[model samples]
Target: MREMNYFIVGDVHGCYYTLKKLLQNWDSDRQKLIFVGDYINKGKHSRKVVELVRELQYRYPGTVCIKGNHEYEMVRYIEDGTKNSDIKENFRNTLMDYDLRNKYRDDVKWMKRLPLYYDDGDIYVTHAGVNWLGLRKFKENSSWCVLRYRGRLKRMSRLQVFGHTPTESKRPEFNKKSNAINIDSGAGNFDNMSAVLIDDAGKIRKIYTEQIRKEDYH
Candidate 1:
């Protein structure tokens, strides 16, 4: 049982360079990279981001890549071409970015199996915040909960961290009232990319993409 630090990153919507910058100092051997989903769509290098995540997961054990709504739509579009309209319009760009528009079956298959959330007693990580009804209701809602629920959530026994709703603020959104942290400050919503480091006891140390690209720091 190797000791590992938990690092959660929210929504990497095709910002390949930004994601690269964020991981430049990451210690994969000792830190677990938990992505809170929405890894694709809205960015130019969606393929590269996916590839990088796969590569990192291969190099590091305990790395968790939970699925986002975009992934769910991508899987649907891949499985049934006429399934989703929004994704269908942007599907070519997404596939072409990786050198394929109607293929990459393996990647699609990989995305399909991504879990919706992860919990480890003290912290809860999901693509979106759990609704006010609580965890049991969240489980019952499943994809709806992970993909659509919004606003401040009710406080739970553990800290809840999520990233589906993008915030205009440059920093990750933290709600003291609900004990929820939103890390989706990335270019997915045309803002800076943010990543948070959580210690074994659930303390947060946040870093934004501009830390390395200081010229863009605002």
Candidate 2:
């Protein structure tokens, strides 16, 4: 079997232009693109970002899109129509984006089916890093631990890559203690989106970033 390199993307959070620009570095012929979710909300182009992600999946058969906390919250909002003001506030931009495009129902369905994580033996990609004892629990319950956990991660057998809590430096952060990486550059909330290239051996080769364009978030 051919060993495929991975381009693990961070939390997109609806920065379509930023994602579009960063993806320019992806080499589809040799690299499998993996998105660590949070594709919508917080920014202005949630609809466009989702559409682009779908298009990439359609065109690239091996693309992996893992579910993030934002996606989980979105599903809950659609299903419960909860009166929680915080949830409503968090989803305001995304809801408006999909409402204008009339794609909320369909998009929610797609988001619901997304897997919580992606593991390729050599590397494990998820929205949040699970603790040493939490992996099995995360699988059994699909709980918030996998989607929202922000504590220090335990070192795993394989390299762990995740994005949820944005890096304070607005760049990918590597933790030698846990052998993990956090690639969320806070695209929707900050100025840039980030991605990391990992080789077949699970070693991060490089980091890529794209500045969020005003048109993408305004």
lDDT by residue (tens digit), candidate 1, 1-218: 77667778878777777888877657777677899988777777778788889988887757999888888777766677653344555565676555433556778888888887899986899888787766453452354476657765868777788987777676787788888888887556557777887777777765555422332222
lDDT of 2 at 150: 73
lDDT of 2 by residue, 120-168 (tens): 6999998887766665536523554678777878788889999888888
Residue 182 in candidate 2 has what lDDT?
93
Candidates in order, TM-scores: namely 0.85, 0.91
Candidate 2, RMSD to the unseen true structure: 2.4
lDDT of 2: 0.83
Computed on alpha carbons, the lDDT of every model, listed in order, comes to 0.74, 0.83
Which one wins on lDDT?
2
Clashing pairs in 2: none
Question: Candidate 2: misplaced stretches above 4 Å?
Answer: 83-86, 100-102, 135-144
* lDDT at 137, model 1: 34
